[model samples]
Each structure stands twice: as C-alpha cells, then as structure tokens.
Target: MRKIPKPTLIAKDVFLECISTVGNLLLKQNYEKCQDLVEAAAQDFDNKFPLLEIYQIPRNLTVLGSIGKEEMKSVYTYRMVKDGMPGNTFYNTLKNSAPYGKCPLCSVRFVETLDHYLPKSLYPILSVVPVNLIPSCSSCNTGKKISFPTNSIEQTFHPYYDDIQDESWIKATLLPYDPFGFNYFVECPDSWEQIKKDRANNHFSSFKLNTLFTAHANEEFRGAKDHMKTLFNLHPDELIKHLDGAFRSRRDQLGINSWQAVMYYCLLKDNWFVQGGVLTF
Candidate 1:
C-alpha cells in the first residue's frame, strides 16, 4: 500500500550482532557456522525479491547444529526483540522504519511489530533477514500471511520493492441499496501487465483493505452527517463542492487511491447522495 526505504543494514551485520549476545558457546559456534549459508541466502533474497523468484531459494529443516526453525525464529524473538539484547537495536530500527510509523499494509493501524514477510516457521534461514521483515499492525500481521508464490500473480506487494503510489487504483462505488454505503475496489491502469494488475488485486483482498476502508468510512460519514445535511439544505451544489475540496485534499496528502479520497469522489458523483440523500444511512 505504501513504499518504504529498505534497511541499510545487511544480513551479516544483523546476524553478527545477534550471535554476539548469545551466552551458549556451542550454539553460538553453530550459528557462526551457519553464517556462510545465511549470507548466501540473503544475497539470493536480495536478488530474487523484486522478481518473485524467491521460491528458487531452498528451504531446509535447520540452520545448523540444533538451530532449527523455531530456534532460528527465537533468534528474532529473544535476541532481536527482547530488551537489553545487542540485536534489539536493529529490531527497534526496523520496527520504527514504518513510514510515519503507520503499517504500510493497511495504512490505518499504527505499527505494533515487525512481521516476517515470509513466515519464519517455513523459511528459517530468513528468520533474521532484514528484507524479510516488514513493520505491520498486529491485525495485519496476524491475518492470512504469505507463502510461496508459484507465479507472478500470486505474489503480494513488498512495500520496500513495490511502489504503486504514483497511480490511482483504489475506488469506491455507491451501493445505493438498503445499506446505502459504498463498496471499495481497485481500478488499476490498463497499461500495466495483467500479472501486475493481479498482484495489486491480490494485495487488496489479501489485506482486506476494502473491509477496513468501508468500516472506517462509515464511521467518518456518521460523524460528518450533520455537516453534510447542513450543506445539502443550504444548497446541493454546496455539498458537492465541499466533497470536491475534501477529495482533493485527501488525494494530495494521501495517495489518490486512499479510501478517504475515493469515498469523497463516490459521494460527490452520486446524485442521490447530494440531493438530500445524505440523510439516508
């Protein structure tokens, strides 16, 4: 949903920082032994990340010695996230990297944790990889997560890699029914490849952006109902003008596909809504 700068730190630096704080001698030695494989995997991740070729990298049962999936995952949970650990600095840095401190996935919720772009349970080698982690809200992080993308269309957008902010895709249509609310969707550019469009669509549905936006939009409309009624009573044109200005502001400040802008656009264009239809639910 939003593009964020990739972390300047690479895999080896973060790995070394974490391994330095480990008190277990044999475990530390084993982690050190795995460093070569970790760095190589990290390089493969960096190379294949943008292309959805990450599935090309191999997955194994363990990192090295007894450092299996959950153990590798704990390197993140204990060393990286736990307080006073040497690697906690990198953890906080990555967690704080969210743009304006908002979860890039939903853009509404404040970031609460760093989510593994690829689950650590499956890809243990990438458990501590920087690029594999994304700052996200608890809700977004817990929802149905990503797995291997067998093809281009199934791949979700990586905020650090994918930037769709330049174009408007998010759209809302007046339901004009008993609910009398708007439904959210995307209208991606025709110039984009079919696979690109599919990926955008997948990101929207996978994150449940439509449901999130609609719920918030209803709250906003309810709070602004009195103002809308007043504007409509004064003049229908005044209502449209207010919405027009609001849409422009939201579009300028947020991206054009932002729910607020599209919601305003939908309302302003609806004849029923402007001509005293503002009173309806």
Candidate 2:
C-alpha cells in the first residue's frame, strides 16, 4: 500500500460544519432532544478521534436521531456526511490529497471516492472527520466496507500512518510457459516483526492484490515480447545488465516492490529466464 499525505483540512472544522448542518435539519424536524444529543456526540467524537483513540469507542445509538440508529446512519451516510454541501467540499479535499489522483490504497485505480477508514455506519460521529476519511477507488472501498480491526495487529495498513514503500516486500515468480505468467506474493523482510508480516499479508489478501498484479504482469509481458526477443540477441551478460537497469528504473519511478520492478528483478535473477526461458514464449 502507498503512503498518502495527511489531509490539510482540519478535522474539527469539518465536524463542526457537519453538526451545524445536521443540527439545522433536526431543528426543522422538531427533534430538539436529538439536536442536543448530537452536540454531546460531537464532543465525544472530538475526544475519541482527534485524540486518536477512536477504535476503542463503541457505537452509541442513543445519541443518534429520534427516528433511531438506522435512520441516523442513513442521514449521515447519504445526506449529511457524503452528499450535503459541506460534504462535497470535504470529499473534494480528500480526493485532491491523493498523489496524481491515484488511489493510495492500491496505487492502481484512480481516486473515485472517499472511504471511511472507520465505517461511518459504525462510527457515525466520525462520518465527516477528515482523519477518518480516505481517498480510494471503488474496488478498495467496496472490498473494505464496514470492516474494522478487532485488534492492533488486525488493523490494515493506514496510508496516513504506514509507509511500507521504503522496503521491498512484494515479490513475484515467473511461470515458464508459452504465455508466460507470474504469481505475486508478500515476502516481507526477515527483520520485520511477525505482526507486521501478518498485517502485510492481510492487506494483500483483503484487496486481492496478488490476482490484480498477476493479470497486470501478464498484460505487460505480452507487450514486451518483441523487446525481450531483441534483448535476447544481445550477449547474455549484457542482457542481465539491461534487465537490472530496467528493474532499477521501475523501482525509482514507482516503489521498490512495484510489480514491474519485482517482475524484472525476478526475471534477472532466474538463470533459465535470463538465458533462454523467455524464448519459449
């Protein structure tokens, strides 16, 4: 997963805006008790979220609308937190924070929507909290919908907090066949703690990243067939050097474990592949 910069929009400001909008709506609906409860919820939210202990808190249905928790969740999910006037501005800011408008969660698809790091349904108070919102693609958002970690070890890597790109963790192995294929896997450093390794594997599996990368690698290999043939004509020693250069280039452009870098590096290391394995295709 890619590390995303923290959003510039202040969380308190966004929370206040949401409260104001929702408060006005509640007043119009003649739910003064609910409006007062919302104010209390706002204070509780600030303590939980801004203080960074939100995960420990449980969903309090009592503070929600008089209509009930389900209705309150719907109002926040659809109206107040996602589609309302302030929400539009909030969503845009989070989306713009993504580098090159790409989803930070997978570093693949374009940023299409904001995902609640903590699902808004479970933590309605955090529905509009800037720190709780993440810019994401539809796939990542849907795959991760409403799933929160039960423990610290189970927590998926947060782009705002985790930056695993500094190391090479993802790896691939070539399948020598006519239509050469690859398999991607998480191979975390031996120095990493067991918890980190588990989390990395969890992130990869949860997003089905291995399947996605394998498909991409196959497509990339198809396009590089002619180039590989041309490189094979060069001295085998030079071919290794060229492949290493390509690996480095991809690593520099993307991260160390980017699919291209991993693919090229693995190919360069495989004696059969560097010599004549690719020619079979």
Candidate 3:
C-alpha cells in the first residue's frame, strides 16, 4: 500500500462547513430545536478526530440523513459530507498526492472515490471529518463498506499514520507451472509486535490485497516472460544481474515490497528461475 499525505484541509473548517450546510437543511426540515445540539456535536467531532480517538465519539445525533430515518434515502445525502463541497476538495488533494493517481489502499486501481476510514454510518459525527476520509479506488471502498475496527489493535494501517513502504514485507512465491502462478502475502517483520502484525494481516485480508496482487503479478509475469527468454538467450550468465537490477529499479520506484520488486527478487534468488526455468512455464 502507498503512503498518503495528511489532507491539507483543516478538519475544523471542513466540519463547520458541513454543519452549516447540514444545519441549514435541518432548519429547512423544521428541526430548529436541534440546531444547538448539532453545533455542539460538530465541535465535539472536530476535536475528537485529530486525536485518533474516534472510537470514543458518541453517535447520538439525529440529524438530516441519519440511517435510522427512512425519510433520508441515503446517508451521504447530507451535503457537507457529499461530493462537490469539501469532500471533492479533499478527494482531489488526495488523488493528486498519490503516485500516478493510484489508490493508496491497494496501489493498483485508479483512485475513483473516498473511503471513510471510520465508516460514516457508524461514526456519524465524523461523517465529514477530513482526516477520517481516505482516497480509494472503487474496489477497496466497496470491499471495506461499513467495517470499522473496534479497538486500536484491530485498526487497519492508515496510510496517513502507518508507512509500511519504508520496509520490505510483501513476499511472492512462484508455483510450478508452464506459466507460473504467483501467490502474494504480507510477511511482517519480527520487530513488530503481535498486535501490529495481526493488524497488517487483517488489513491484507480485509482488503483482499493478496487476490488483487496475485492477479496483477500474473499479468506482469505474462508480459515479462518473453523478455526474460530474450535476455536469457542473449546472456544467460548476466540473467541474475539483469534481474537484480530490475528488482532494485522497481524497489526504488515503488518500494522494497512492491509486487514487481518482490517478484524480481524471488526470481533472481531462485536458482532454477535465473537459469530460465520460467521459459518452460
């Protein structure tokens, strides 16, 4: 996963803007009695989010588009949290910050939308909190729909908080076949505590990262097969060197554990693979 820079927008500003828009809508809904409560709730939300203590925030407000009210057709109908306002600005900033505009959660798909790091449905107070929203591809967003961690240990790696890219953790293995099948997994370092490691594994499983990585790796292997054969034919002795160089290049461009880097490293380290074993596959 790619690391994401913290959003440039101020959380309090975004929260107040949302409160103003939603509060105006609430006023239109004849909920004048609740305005003071809404304002207080908004302030509370703004304060709590930056502390990374979202789990403690209460979900007591009954506003315009809360899930309990069938009158509100969609939770996102609340304009403050809706696209085209601060949400759009936040999304644009995140997308622009990403490497090649790819989703930070998977680093594969193009970022198409935002995922609520804390599901807005559960944490309605943070429905429009800038830091709670994450730029995501449709796949990761849809897959992560409504799932929130109950505690800090269960929390998935936040691209804004956790930077796994600095270290090598992702690993790949080639399966025996004519066109080899690849399996990808997160291999957490021993230095990490069990909770941290478990969370990493949970994040990988929750996002179906392995499945996505394997599909991409297979496509990459197919594309690289002919090139590997050509290179091996020209200079069999230099195949390992070429593969090592490729690994380093990809590692530098992406990260040490990027799929391409791990794949190249594995291929170079495998005696059979460097001798053009992949050619038979």
- Tens digits of lDDT, candidate 3, 18-63: 3344435654344333344445655564465445455566554345
Residue pairs with backbone overlap in model 2? none
For this target, which candidate reaches the highest lDDT against the unseen true structure? 1
* Alpha-carbon lDDT, every model: 0.84, 0.72, 0.68
Error of 2 at 32 (Å): 10
Which of the predicted structures, 1 or 3, would earn the higher TM-score when compared with the native? 1
Give candidate 2's error at residue 57 in angstroms: 3.4
Two-way TM-score contest, 2 vs 3, winner: 2
> Which residue pairs show backbone clashes in model 1?
none
Model 1 has how many clashing residue pairs?
Answer: 0
Instruction: Estimate, for each residue in 1-281, the C-alpha lDDT of model 1 and write its tens digit.
Output: 87898888879889888889788898888888888788887888888978778666677768777779987888888989899999999989998998789899888889999888777888898888998889999988988445556566777888888888768878898776776566999789989888788888988988899999999887788788799888888988888899999999998887777788888988988888888778765
Clash pairs detected, candidate 3: 178-281, 179-281
- lDDT tens per residue, model 2, 1-281: 78887665665555445445555675436333454455455456445543335467676554444545565565445544466556566767777888888888887788988887777677665566566678899999988622876655556777876789879899999988755799999999999988789888888887788887888888988888668867787766767788899899999987787778888888889899888776777
> How well does candidate 1 match the true structure in TM-score terms?
0.94
Candidate scoring better on TM-score of 1 and 2 = 1
- lDDT: the better of candidates 2 and 3: 2
Least well predicted 10-residue stretch by lDDT in candidate 2 = 27-36
